[model samples]
Target: MSVDEVAALSLTEVAHKIAAKELSAVEVTEASLQRIERHNEALNCIANVNAEDALAQAQKADERLAKGGPVGPLHGVPLAHKDMYYRAGRVSACGSKIRADYVPDITSTALKKLDAAGALEVARLQMVEFATGPTGHNEMAGTPRNPWNTDHITGGSSSGSGSAVAGRMVYGALGSDTGGSIRIPAYCNGLVGMKATYGRVSRYGAMPLSFSLDHVGPLCRTVRDCAVFTQVIAGNDPDDPTTSREPVGDYLADIEGGVSGLRLGVPTNHFFDDVDDEVREAIQESISIYEKLGAEIVEVEVPGIKHGFALGEVLGRVEAATYHSTWLRERPEDYGTQTRNRLMQGFYYPGTRYIEALNLRGQLLSGFTDEVFSVADILIAPSVPMAVPTIADTDISANQGFLDMIARFGSCTRPFNFLGLPALGVPCGFTGNGLPTGYQIVGRSFDEATLFRAARAFERETGCTENAPVL
Candidate 1:
């Protein structure tokens, strides 16, 4: 297959092809490297490309396949990830200048699992400094550009993951979501990203912005690809006690089961308050699509949802501040303007307020699920409330507009993080500006399978996943 043909296949498709011997692992890896070499200069999405090591691994994968031993589901696939997941003896910059040279002795559980699954780590992708920003603006490391429109923002902290995958540079990439890091980028870049329920995946060896809100997940071109990736990385880990002991479900088993007889809730509250008209129209159209797919669209009230964002801010900032206290005290100069400023606020949050926020999460989650999920199997909302903004417009400075825009970026996504529910962002349509916009479907904790099923149904009906940025 040609390089473009190889790049065009979804992660799952490429994996199948490699296993079936239609494409050698070396050919696929070389194609991915070619795309990165050609496009990374323009998009600024790749932090560091491990060309030699990746090619060597790909050769080994092919050799193993030739031996006819049991092959993993992700056998011979190439993937890049945000610059935060640690691999023993390798640097994990976490998109910050402070950690640019920081190498860890421990490999992240997620990466280890992916390595075991026969996935190759081709590159380390760029991200917001310390995973603190929503707008993919990393001053120390260059900001990643959206592939769809080079001048626009790639909603971040998973900035490069979104850019690389949507730009067709890599099959898939792991993205960590804390306050919508994964979903926002997915929305802006027109890919599917899932922020699984907190504890659904282990966070060991991954950089942490917020202990309470941090979630590790994947950003992929399609929902099925996302499902397969998530399936590989998810499950209990002995190293991270926070990981849930709950059995991981087969996300792909019934992904094509369709949404028949399912109740999909459209919020009558916070999700639409300040949403742009174009975005609202796209979401409504998606709801109509769901209604046509044998799913019931119900208007449901989300009780106590208004406080979610603020409470999440309190808990998140405190946790973030606690994590960075030492760095903020020393080597503060190394941090970027926006990340340093954002992390600084975490210190000022009163202990009482942080405690209160933590205290309210379970109460709010219980009330939210009992009231909303009781009436509907899933809740659908805009992944981002506004159209994708220009990089120049959202570049962080001492501007009130920048703050408002950043806050708006996370408005729809952070709530789910705070509530610790599983949320998946799927491309719904394009906005007036010709940029992509998406909707997120939220499900009860550990219920990612249903979210996948519903998203797959929408994807199948609308064929929205067929659109990709012409990088």
Candidate 2:
């Protein structure tokens, strides 16, 4: 296959080629590295590239193939990790000045799983300051440009992962989602980003944003590719007590199944309100496609979604402040204006308010389970209320617009984090200007298999997965 064809192949297809000896792991790794070299300067998607290490690993993968040794599912596939994820001896800035030079002694649980599956991490992708913001504009590390439109923002804090995956710099990358960080960028950049059920994937060694809300997942060009990545990462971890003991289902095995007879709940109240005209049209179009695919779409009511967002905000800020309290006091000036100001606001949350938010969260989750699942198998809605704003438009350097953007993006995504549900953001359509729009498919807790299958079916019908940004 040509380089473009090879680069465009899904992770599963690449693995199949490698197993058949039709393609060498070294060749796949080299192609990804070349793509990075060609696009990284303009996009700023990759913060660190470890070409030498990746190639060495690829060579070993080739040796294993030559010996006919057993290899894992993702064997010989090239991948990247968000800069926030810990890789021993590698600087994990977490998009902050305080920890800019900090390197952890241990690798993150997600990275360990990727490594076990034979995924070679070719680079470290850029992210928001401590995974705090939605826009990809990181003042400390230069903003990661959206590959679709260099002028538009790549949603963050998983900015680089979205940009790189959309730009086809690597087959897939790990991204952490606290509040739509993964899905927002995935939507804006035209990629499939999956935030597995909280604790479905371990967060050990990942730079913590909010311990309760943090989830590590994959951003890829296709829904099935996200499923493949999740299969390798999802499971119980001794290092993380929050991880679920439930078995990780066979995600890829169910991708070809259509969503026929599946009841999909459409929440037209909070999520559909305040969306851009283009985004609204795209979501309606996506719903039509789902209807055509034999899926039942019913309008469902979520009574406490707004309240759930409020609770998540209180908990996230309080927890985030607790983590950064010492740094905020000692080196407040080191943080960006947006980061410092937000962290400072967290300090003002009363002890009673934090406890109340936690209690409210439990009530909201129980209500969500009874209310949302009562009429449908999964809840579907637009991932973001609007298309990506211009980097110049969203004042990431300012305190107000930064906070406003975070609140707006999190309004739709944070509730799921609180409910501990599995949500997948799949590219639905493009806006008039050609920027991508995504629709989120949220499944019951630990039911990522259903979400992935539904997303893949939608992807097939819409042909959005085949679209990539030109670099």
Candidate 3:
């Protein structure tokens, strides 16, 4: 295959080709690196590119394949991850000036799982400073330019993961979601990103944004790629006590299981409040495609969604503030302006309000799930409720409507985080403005299989998964 084709193959396709000996892992990794070298400077996605080490690892993978023993599922797949996931003896700058030079002594459990699966980590991707902001801006490192249109924002804080995967710099990436970190980027970049059911994937080594809300998952080109990668990274981990002990399902097994007869709920409230006409049309088009695939689309009311969003913001700020109190008190100058300003808001949230939010989580979740799930199998909503904004348009420093833009981007997304439900944002169509847009399919807690099944059905119907940026 041509280098371009090698670079553009989906994660599952690349893994299968390598295991079949049709392509060497070195060739694939080199192709990915070459693409990164050619395009990353323009995109500003990778914080630290590990070409020399990745090539060496790829060569070893080739050697292991030559021996003809059983190989792991992702034996030669190349990937990059958000900079927050730790690698012992290496600096996980986490897109923050404060931790820019801090290197951890222990590797993240998620990375260990990927290592055991034989996937090669090629780079550390940029992110929102301290994973605080919703847009891609981070003064500490640099904002990742959206490959679709360099001027547009690649939603954060998994900005680099979305930009890199969409730009074909890597086949897949590990993206953590607190609020809309993973799904927003997916929606903005026209990729598949899953915020697995909270605790479905361990958060052992990732930097915490909101301890109760953070979820670790994958961003990839297709639902199948997302499923394959999620399968590897998920499951119980001793290092993370919060991890669910529920056996991870066969994501690939029933993914092609048609969504026929499955009822997908369309929220009758909140989600469309400020959504652009083009975005709503595109999402409606996606739901129509699901109908053609034999799925029943039902309009349902999701009461208390607003409460979930408000509560999520309160909890997120309080938790992040708790984590950064010392830093905010000592090295306040280190955080980016927007990040620091955002974290500082938490200081004023009264202890009672924080506890009230926490105490109310169970009731809020029950209200959300009971109303939505009782009526439909999964809830579908626009991932970002508006047109994908330009980096200039959403720049917090000069932009007069900072809070408004942030709320628009995170509105439809943060509620799921509060409820601890899994949400997958899959690219469905492009907006009239030509920027990509997507919808989020959310599942009941630990019901990732159903989400994947629905996403795969939509993916197969539209074939929109094949679109790539011309960068």
Candidate 4:
């Protein structure tokens, strides 16, 4: 197959073909590498391309398969991930000057799991410096451009993951979400991105943005791709005690089961109050499709949703600030203006207020799930409420209204991170600006299977997964 042809296959498709011996792992890896080389210059999404190492790994995969031994499910699938995930003896820049050459002595458990599953890592994609910004504005490491519209933002922290996956440089990527990092990028790039329930995946060797709010998940070309990827990485980790002990569900087993009897809730408040007409129209159209698919649409008021966002803001910033306090005091100049200024505010927040914010999370989550889930199986809301903004328009790090822009971009996503619920961003349709926008299906904690099923149902009906940016 040609480079673009091979690179364009979905993660599941590529994996199946490789397992069937219809395609060689080396050929697949080379095709993906060629796409990265062709587009990385314009997209600025890749931090480091592991061409030689990936090829070597792919060759090994082919040899193993030829030997007719039992093979892992993801054998020979080529993937990339955000620069933040660590591999021992390798530089995990974390998209910052502070860690520009920082090499870790331990590999992230997430990477180790993927390695065991036989997936090859093709590259380290760029991200917001230290995963601070919501928009993909990294003055230190160059910002990634949205493949759909290069002038627009790819939505950040996982900016490069969005760009790389959507640009077809790689089939799937691992992205971390502190406050909508994964979902916003998924929304902006027209991909399926999941921020699984808090503690669903380990965070042992990944860069820390907010210890409490951070989540590890996958960004992929399709919902099933996200499902299989999530399965590989989900579960308890001895290295990270925070990982959940809950039995991981078979995400792909019932993904195509459809949403025939499901109740999908639409929030009547904060989620839609600021949404653009184009985005709102797209979401409504998606709801109509769900109704046709036999999903009963219910309008429900999310209890304390606004307060949840406020508390999350307090907790996330304070946690991030605490982590970077030493560097803020000593190597302040090494950080970008936005990241530095953002982290500085954490230090100023009163300890009592921080404690209160931490205390309120459980109360808020219980109240939210009790009220929201009683009426709906999963809540459907805009992943990003506004029409996608241009990079120049949102490049407000030095501007006075930087916080407002960040808040606007994260208005729909941050609250869930605080609530620690699983949310999936699936492409519904595009706004008038020619950029993609999507809705997130927020499920009960650790109920990622339901989220995947609903998302897959919509994906099948709308054929949304078939759409890709014409890079």
RMSD to the hidden true structure, all candidates? 0.8, 1.2, 1.1, 0.9
Higher-TM-score candidate of 2 and 4:
4
Better of 2 and 4 by lDDT: 4
Give the winner by lDDT: 1 or 2: 1
Candidate 3 weakest lDDT stretch, 10 residues: 396-405
lDDT of 1 by residue, 13-50 (tens): 99999999999999999999999999999999999999
Task: List residue ranges in candidate 2 displaced over 4 A.
Answer: none
Please give the ranking of all candidate structures by lDDT, highest first, separated by commas. Answer: 1, 4, 3, 2
Report residue 32 deviation for candidate 3 (angstroms). Answer: 0.8
State every prediction's TM-score relative to the real structure. 0.99, 0.98, 0.98, 0.99
Winner on TM-score (1 vs 3): 1
**Which of the two candidates, 3 or 4, achieves a greater TM-score against the reference?**
4
What is the TM-score (0 to 1) of candidate 4? Answer: 0.99
Q: Give the TM-score of candidate 3.
A: 0.98
Residue-by-residue lDDT tens digits, candidate 2, 327-359: 988898888887778777788889999999887
What is the clash tally of candidate 4? 0
Q: Which stretches of candidate 4 lie over 4 Å from their true place?
A: none
Per-candidate clashes, comma-separated: 0, 0, 0, 0
